[model samples]
Target: MDTSNEPHIAHKSHLPHPYDQDISHVLRHLSRITATGRKKLANSLSTAGYLAAGMWLIERNLGPDAARSACASGSRRSLERPLLGFLSQRAVAAAVAENPPPFPSRGGVPRLRTTWRSQSDFIADLINFAMWPTNYHPGYLEQRAVTTKRLVVGEDFVRAVHETAYLHTAESVRMPSVRLSLALMVLADGDDRVQRVLTDTYRGYLSSWKQVYAEVLRARGLRLRAGLGLDDLANALSAATDGVILRSIGDPHAGVVDRGRERTLMGTVALAVMHGFLEPAEDSDGLTLEQAVHARLGRPRPSGATRSDALRGERNPNP
Candidate 1:
């Protein structure tokens, strides 16, 4: 099979000696097992247990020689580096596979409308799509922000931002790929190579989201207040999102909700951040912030958009 187009977990030079092919075989087998579901496994397994399970499966299929080679002469540590990469790659692949072609609209949240010019750019988009929330359909925000002649800079814009934050927090709490990502994060802490990959992944994730937020602001003729910039809002929201996800992981009911109201923890933090940063653009047709927000909330949602619908074309919203 021509794997030239397939995403690799690591560079050729970074793979462990003599075990790279073996690792690939092992991963393929693991994928098959997960897909077939012929055998049952424990629902809760520690990271170490997960690793052990992989090794056991590999040994079972390829025999003790493969397992012994991986453990010999500090090769086990080397082997682990690619495993972390595999997890990250798998998360990305699973996300992409779930949300296939026709860019943007098939998935609940649109795939980025931008085309990637390089492998790095493409990988970054895959990672971004994997992490995006999926409560709203494609063109949901766009339909609201852009009117017949011009972009509407009012309540719809504010509500769109708030909805994005709320859905991101809500979906991330239950996303399976997020669990794998969290595990990968903990495992990458001491490994320099894996840490580099993780750092790059997150940088790309942040950059993609920054662009989305910036585009949304541009579409609605909004700007950051005073000294604030797009980067500030993106970074703040990113940090808050991380904190919320972590808190929600530990306490299932924590960050996903805000006092049982219609808002979310992330929504509150996002709005607070926006309050300090977002403002009407000078060209917003003389619409003040208060007037824009107080505009009626009765406008009908765009066609095919729904708050309760399942994410079409994907298994999980946040991958």
Candidate 2:
């Protein structure tokens, strides 16, 4: 009997360490698609209405080295447009056809049924909508705040995941300390506040977000982390102009920009979620390890170029 060809599967009870998980999942967008001439994947998701779990996985698996590939972008689109889950076992197998990860094999077995839910789903969604809110009413401003408020349901969702799926989200994603939690993370300062922050002037809010985040970091002094906090993180709340924040905290008159920017200064939130600044409320939307992987990662997109530019491919002779 030859036992050398055996494969191993990492169970939910044991996942990559939390910091590693964040590194691989969130930062993976910068990875190159592949050395075989693939596209570079986007660092974030397309329909960022919710945090794209697949993107998170890519950040975890791939690293800065893969950032140059365009193939990665296409893969992200594949996961984003339809909101589908992980790659088919065939797809995964096909990807690793020539050079597979040293990770244990599947023994020719299937990757098991996937459930596209996770503990980070809801608050992550809030973060998503906050980043880019399009197509809505003036009243949406009022409703949006309630939407981002951390849900009590997340706690039960976390427990259910622990008992049922056998998934092991890092403890950091589940915040144990509020002083160092996601609520304190800043999105933008002055011109950066995306979620209809009294859009009299866009530039001001975004600037305020940066200042506020810096203040929070200063105020909290490295004791916090990111995730859904007790505060309403979705409503573009900021410590920037208090008058704007006070007047617009629940204002029913505001515009949900049709083309909100995708990128945000959410590194704090990303760090917080990875470090347990946020806890699982009773109703956290549960996502399986599989769902998170698929949502956070992808195969990369092809270049839109129809004509190949030979000069572009060649190294700069001057350099």
Candidate 3:
């Protein structure tokens, strides 16, 4: 764990915390989960969407150092075409391999080949469609807002975040937090570039959870205690996730790699923290420790790179 090239937090100002007066109304996304099944469905979609995109990039040999160079403020946009071409080729190759078509007859008239679209566009559109409503009719929007208030401070928000962490650390890919830690090691101490990236990425990454927590508090007819707010909670959670991830990687037998232990632990901590800020709601999603263990162990472990094997850039077992 030589962290010489990684970034470290020397101070808070370089990575300023997100500060907003109130929760934004964007939590309309999570509001759609009225039933237990729907919540699970939404969470699954979110998990697959993020993991797939990350694996696709990593399989293409992208690494943190490469991402940092490409993600430079002005250079990211220039990568669209090349990245798209590569993705298109991979897509076509996969399609051909999985569902081979008959070759065209030499005597037949030439058929036009479809042009390749950027894989990034495909992913962006997929995520956008999944997140936002397709129809903006007044009636639909109104109904949406009504459904959005279902779980402001209960287990739904916590579960979504928990599932995301589970998926990121699944056996199929290298643990993302480990990757981030290594990435930070490569940066100069307190470098503005690293700080900017951390702040912007964390702000965007945790925005949904923050909004959900705010809505939950409002629904519970409560507000955060003095000196504690949604932003503070979010930053704390981020730190916790990072800390636990580092620990798990460094010590796999510490119960983190023990099926649902990690997810359950984080979820419990979140619920406890919420209770500290607001009154406990009667309708909390009662995810008992036994249930968490059952659910976690029931699923087949994801196959591919596990442990630190993927860190060395060996062949990825996942597509």
Candidate 4:
């Protein structure tokens, strides 16, 4: 039978031409996923490959090859089953790549037990981790990365704080859009797994701030105020940062900082609010927190106070 004009014949003719478009689509999608995500997708592909092997066997025995002549028939039968299997596996790979799974831990949330060198060091590390591009993947996996990152980010934010006051002139703020957006979606969708991870992440992050604040107070020989705690300060800082990140992502002109004043103004205002709550530690020329506070508040200096007395809260009687 003549099959020259047949659809199957036409399809077989084009088979040797290569499906560049389909290959490009898969490559493009893979590029958007993280290295970790790609690993997960590769595992999925392995599983799908096994399944496809079984289907290929069944196709060889009883598929449409029986209806055509040997020349046209064998080619279609040899190619069609594997092609279908490949496409199916590709689809599965794409899905897995886009949504990599979270890591499982027996413990509640991982915490960093080591001490930070200083508050500045702690803040710098936190900023670097949070602002990194690696943590910005748009998936549950991204949330997991943040959860782990926060274990090190150590937590706490506040709006009525002066920390954000310096943020007005800050040049660039990094917002991990993919991770933050996933967090928002997880919270909205009520994904309990991601939510639990996020909670643990925050806890670990807040704990670090407590340590930082304690060290800061100790260096100045000052006590925490009766009504305040390290956790409170950390909470305020965290809130301010989250707010700024959200605002930055929502604004249409958020990336216009270089060429446009309006966008720069918007960024300044957002960053200012963030900075007010996250007051970076100041180097106060060898003064203690008590002395600094007293000076700022216009109170009389403690009688016979030395630098040691200022740091120790009271003069050493032996000296």
Candidate 5:
């Protein structure tokens, strides 16, 4: 792939001339996914999201060959088995757009950046802390040499590290394609603690694009004490997910309890579907995900709200 043709932002839609054509191929692929497919996309997301993300680290820092080798590890094998949930999330987003009553538009979902951000580093800190209950991943882990000229950390771990980020940009930035990447990583073993924290902490965020998930709040750099309001357009989905969890505790397929990594990834796609994180449709409303995100920015978060927070400390609050 030509780096020159790559869209600058993951899940991005806007592009300069000529390069725009490459984006079109991807966007068109997204538009074709069906409602059932979206549902599957959501459910299929798992460790793969993080694993694929790790690949991004290689692409940007280590070169593609090293990244491919990492994918063949025991970690990568784990993600392969649980892809349906991730796919479900993708299906749901597309389905939601099919319904116009709640959303403003239904076309042109935006692109997502595959690489984990500095916020990823923060989550990793928390994860490493949680894993040992009182330890870090060692500076060496974060500073591993991926290439002669570049150093690498678990930057891609953020993809499966939490669904909070996906929920953060859900309504305005639907990108189920990346959810496939997330599932792949979740299957891999980049960071297990990150998975646990997100599952336990952000349960309610899975509801809809409206209410803020607690973990995502923390991820966005909001202090635990800060108060965040719900998005009016998305409150219903939030409640719905909450209801399913409550009712699903005893059901066989939907209610059965999952253990270990399976336990944390449980209901991931189900919630994504309820929340509206699917791809966009053509000729629907021309509402690209980028527009939704831009519209979200137009409406201010609380006065104390901050955007794009980076991790600074290595202390694990959970520890």
Candidate 6:
């Protein structure tokens, strides 16, 4: 195949320009490349090395010898820019797909099974899907935290927080997409267009989380500590989650916990942060924090059960 007429091929296909043309064909071809080459791109030491590996993959898949010669003959820069664009777009798509907005209703019918009882449950479900994106089925996970008479920050809440941490830790360790997107962001440094896309995606991510946080708090009749704004809490949690995930990537053992442990590193940190920011609604029935949590979990409190036992995961009345 004559590769010099790549732009002409796009024009003939009625695409606007080579850079603006649909690159799904390129993506398909790239997908056929060996896993080792894709891994090389992810582990590349520099942007130039990453682009070089990408070009090699393109040449290998697009055409055997002709594409290589053409790529070497003063077309490298032209192809490199578009290839980077394609990658940036993919990174944005992956981010969006990973953090879909929760849908509470479908065709005017409420989704009861997916309804969340608290912010912890909502975030736990989010982490589950984020960790295993392949398992997420649209409409199956539509979740909305329902309004309740009182928000109990008790047993279910603590368990959900721990589960979120465990799943997110596993995601950081196992998801190649997360690492690859981080690599792309690093490579996109100083590139205004790519940076803009990343910035917009991040803003969207924060906005979605903030909305959820605000809604869940209001619905539960809860309030933040004095001088703590909703955006501040949301941003802090987002930053903390990102930091923990990055740490998990660097040290997988950071998320490790003993069997039957109730909290991972992330869960412990998140629980502390939540305690600092959140306060019970001003109303009747002033119960201790441990009591509230246990009551919400609906576990029959054993005689002589203490706060220490509750925190230690010994809530079983019969046991």
The 0-to-1 C-alpha lDDT of every candidate, in the order given, reads 0.44, 0.27, 0.40, 0.35, 0.30, 0.43
Q: Give model 2's clash tally.
A: 91
Provide the clashing-pair count of each candidate structure: 1, 91, 8, 22, 73, 1
| Model 4 lDDT per residue over 37-123, tens place | 543432332222222232232223223231223344666444332322222333323332332212111111011111122222222
Can you tell me which runs of candidate 4 are displaced by over 4 Å? 1-92, 95-178, 185-189, 252-319
TM-score of 5: 0.19
Per-residue alpha-carbon lDDT of candidate 6 for residues 238-277, written as tens digits (9 for 90 to 100): 6777676666555656644322563457667878878766
- The TM-score, computed over Cα atoms with residue i paired to residue i, of candidate 6 is 0.42
Among these predicted structures, which one has the highest lDDT? Answer: 1
Q: Which 10-residue window in model 4 sums to the lowest lDDT? A: 103-112
The estimated TM-scores of all candidates read: 0.42, 0.20, 0.37, 0.32, 0.19, 0.42
- Give the higher-lDDT candidate: 1 or 6: 1
Which parts of model 1 have CA positions greater than 4 angstroms off? Answer: 2-155, 258-263, 283-319
- Cα RMSD to the true fold for all candidates: 20.1, 27.1, 23.3, 21.0, 25.1, 19.1
* lDDT by residue (tens digit), candidate 5, 1-319: 2222223323212322222222211111121246554333222222112222322332332221222323345675543332333223333234333432212112221321122223333233222222221122234223222211121122343343233322322211122222222333455355554454445333433352223333333333322111213342244444444343333332435533333223322235434532333222221222333443443454555565443211111122134
Regions of candidate 6 where Cα sits further than 4 Å from its true position: 1-155, 184-186, 256-263, 283-319
Give the Cα error of residue 231 in candidate 6, in Å: 2.0
The true-versus-predicted C-alpha distance at residue 258 of model 6, in Å, is: 7.3
How far out, in Å, is residue 177 in model 5?
A: 37
- Error in Å for residue 312 of model 3: 59
Q: What residue runs in model 2 are displaced by over 4 Å at the alpha carbon? A: 1-57, 60-89, 95-102, 107-109, 112-234, 237-319
Alpha-carbon deviation at 39 in model 6, angstroms? 30
Query: Ranking by lDDT, best first?
Result: 1, 6, 3, 4, 5, 2
| lDDT computed for candidate 5 | 0.30
lDDT of each residue in 12-32, candidate 1, tens digit only: 222332222222211211212
